[model samples]
Target: MAKPQKRYVCQACGSVATRWQGQCADCGEWNTLVEEAGATVTPFQAKHNLQGGGRTFQLVGLDAEIALPERMGSGIAELDRALGGGFVEGSATLIGGDPGIGKSTLLLQAAARMALAGASVAYVSGEEAADQVRLRARRLGLGNAPVQLAAATSTRDILTTLGQGTPPALLVIDSIQTMHSDLIEGAPGTVSQVRASAQELIRFAKERGTAVVLVGHVTKDGSIAGPRVLEHMVDTVLSFEGERSHQYRILRAIKNRFGGTDEIGVFAMETSGLSEVANPSALFLTHRDEGMTGATVFPALEGTRPVLVEVQALVVRLASGATPRRAVVGWDSGRLAMILAVLEARCGLSFSTCEVYLNIAGGYRVQDPAADLAVASALVSALAERAVPADAIVFGEIALSGEVRPVAHAALRLKEAAKLGFARALAPVATAGEGGMTIDSFKTLGSLTDHLLMR
Candidate 1:
């Protein structure tokens, strides 16, 4: 018999090492490495396994007939939208978010709604007691929902209880980090433990045709707290994002094997619980004063939905020899630097001696490159003390050479903007706006700057 080797795994990132180190080399977290026990490797085992003793399985052709996976609607339209229509039977979904950001509330709401709609739903919480969950459900006006609830941290006990009965249509694990598996030697939340617990639950789902929804805890950086493989093991990954202070929450699909990625469902935290926001643009857009200098509205597209958001900028001239600070919120800082460079080099606008602040209103983050034109418009409007027309929306990409570039779904963006009562658009040249809105097209950054200055 050969002695088993001691393996160390990083708790922050699932990297393995032969020995412990002060800091993890992969994720650079200090004191995160812990030892785990594994089976010993024997020299003769490698030589003996050249051929397999497994039973043969049939292989199917690419043209084989198949049926689309059936879906189970959660009875909540917003949750179903984030889930790409509805939850498919036997699928595993992982949802992660910051603490106290309404993860439990949303899941409880879904579970209650599904139960009320006559689906067999089981909600197991490792983080809360059954009575606590019941109290919350009652507070959410779901006191009469017939959903089955339990408080268990042991993976074996939870699986065994569910195995004895007819499998439920849905099973919700309140959080994966708190789940413990006796098959794994490490404690819960460890790399080995999370991987093992999730694997077992996913296997149960597959064998029993139960749609499993696992709530995950996010790290300080907002990524799910577990082995990265946990995300890959699931059929869908949903990110719940919102500030605790804000009333709005966004459920964004990061990966969906069955549907389109980047699809988002919007909800607002209300006294009654999480209510669907039918018009997401209303949450992100504030009442703009007429002749406001530093604000421009940009139509942002997420998956197939178009939402309008406000881009705000403020520029202040600095005294001589003072360091000018650049600040940005809800948008990329590097892109801001690039836009400033383009404004100075290609458009002859000087910002080297001025402090600049840029913000996306409503704490809504913008990742669309099309917002480049909008940000530039707001910056120019701020610097020149001129207001971008309140009724006009701006969206386009800016090239390094200062040319304004057209973005995708220009027609779709215009349609949404027109429906919101916008009367005009400042877009790239050749963008077709056939929606009865006036289009003021620009070719270059200099021309856009000239348009703002002249106005």
Candidate 2:
């Protein structure tokens, strides 16, 4: 018998190497390579011919008519929205989040709702036992749902049992890291084991026309803990994001084969269970008796939804000989620095002798460029110790040259702001207004700076 070949594989990126190396050449991660035994191949197997040994199938053209995959609702509107309407049959989805971030709770609630809707659903837990799941269900008041529960880690056993009966319409794997495959040699959570286990489960889902939802753990850097290919192999990738100190959770789809990317679903975690937040804007806006310096209201767009959030900034004069400090939360520090540079260079503002702090209210993150004008307004207001108009909202992209640029969905954002009782908006020059709200348009940052400072 030929000796089994040995190889090294990077646990982080799944790059294989013939010899052991300290660093992975593919991803540049150090000390992640582990030695593993490769499959043995005989001389006869190596010389086997494949020219005429297998069956052939006809290929169809792009115009071939095919039925669209059916979608099954989980009875949770927020979850369904995040999943692009609903879960598609024969699809595999991977959800990643930090521990205690309600990944299991959300899924359990969804599974129970689906079961209540008269669909057969099975939930397999690799981290928790069936009794623990039952207790959790009781706590969430979903103990009476007809959802099947099992606590198993062996992929072979799970597949064997599912193969014997009618395939469930939905199958949820509590976590993919703890699952082990008998065909693979490595232990559970290893790169090979994770890849192989996910492959088998995905294959079963496609062949049996069942929807599979796989729970994944995130690394300290907030990325899914597995090979990069693990993300590519799934049909949909959803990220559960929220600050542990906050009660709101955001379900965002980063990649989807059957739906549009960047779509978000909002949920509020409560004692009963995760409740859907129909109006997310109201959750992020704080009612203030009076407008204060360094505070500006910004209408931000999260995917297709327009949300109103407050942007705050503080500028404190540093003592002589002290280095100025800059800190930011819920926004990019680099972008903040860039905006500061523009203020100093284009608007003739002095910030080098002061410490600046920026924050987005309600612990919500803002990625839209339309926030640039609002952020700049807050910073300048802080520096001048003057408050922006309490009933006015600001939104527009600021170019490096200090010009205010137009953003998409201007009408949608203004409508959302108007519905929240804002009487005026400071936006790009071309933005149109509705609902009798006063529109103040600025072509350049200098005009906005002059208006705020000269007031």
Candidate 3:
């Protein structure tokens, strides 16, 4: 006969507090704490834990032989590539992205395709009405698909209905944030509610051997909203990323228990639906003008695929007594600052009096450290009013001491570049020339700057 205790949880970081507070002590965010009811445990219940009530599982040896898990393809090559082949039975997947990033569209397309391929698919939308989703499906030319669609937010109703029938091969929940669980006290998007709802759905997925796909909303900083444990509860985590003004979207695999992580699937959003891009390099790399200054081609490797993108830089000298401005797009500003510092201190380049602007062409974001060489080449070319070779690609890492460092998959990058009609490479000295392409290797960043200046 104990009273239920009240607890406050931080919606930002899932930290629990005894009482309401203005700021979350763990995440330093203000106005995110919300109250929730904690379970009541009597004194007898707390001390009556016995070890004999649980069923034990058999321990298996590491050398035990087993068959590979069966996969169900969504009939999309790029998506299959990112998923490390296809969706596995009894696996739970969580995909998150910013608003209007085509997450629901992509999932709808997959569900339609799977339904057409004779797989039992169910799509439950919590944010949109059934008629609205149907209208979109018709617009996407999937009106004939036999996909079971519903628009309900109650987790209990969804589970109860699905439990009465044969379990579907695939179940897609459009947006976990809008799902409400009656067992939890708070609203849908609260930390406790999201965690409890996801746990229930994942349990259903495991017990019924259904592959579940859960859509998630993202915070302002682009991380998945709700509890961080939500990501860990799923068997796989995918990120859908794209700019609103851009036509291309990338599906990146952040975590996978059945496959390799960091794999990416490229797609372009069109009027009809999302179409897979087999050659993503073509979308990110713009046409190279004959003598375009401040531009360099870079080979970026994502998982097993190689993509070529262009790096562009601009430098304008500012008048004395005026503060110089630094601007960047589609790349990290902190990394750009580091590169500028290295060029000024170790390579004898002076950019203090100039305003610098850096951009990655075609709205593609570059995260590879190998882009350092390409970025430096672009900056040096811009400041000196010179142009890098139109057919040459650049990739390598630069240290603070100015030494050019070799990168992973050098031969793979060269091979990809060669396939794209590039004949020369400006890379680290340790990188060997492959596939009959010439390599202008530099040992240090100082040497690279000298070469660019003298060219």
- Cα RMSD for candidates in order: 12.5, 12.0, 12.4
Where does the lowest 10-residue lDDT sum fall in candidate 1? 45-54
lDDT of 2 by residue, 1-455 (tens): 76677899999999999899889999999999999989897777667868777999999999999997788998999888888889999999999999998999999999999999999999999999999999999999999999999999999999899888799999999899999999999889998999999999999999999999999999999999989999999999999999988999999999989887888899998998789999998998887546589999999887677889999899999888999999999999999999999999999999999999999999899999889999999999999988899999999999999999999999988899889999999999988888889999999999999999988
Q: Write the per-residue lDDT of candidate 3 for residues 255-367, one digit (tens) a residue.
A: 99999988999999999999999999888888888689999999999888999999999999999999999999988999999999999999889999999999998888889
TM-score of each: 0.89, 0.87, 0.88
**Which segments of candidate 1 are over 4 A away from where they belong?**
1-46, 50-52
In angstroms, give how far residue 383 of model 3 lies from its true place.
1.0
- Candidate 3: which stretches are off by over 4 Å? 1-54
* Native-referenced Cα lDDT, model 3: 0.94
- Model 3: pairs clashing at backbone N, Cα or C within 3 Å: none
What clash count goes with each model? Answer: 0, 0, 0
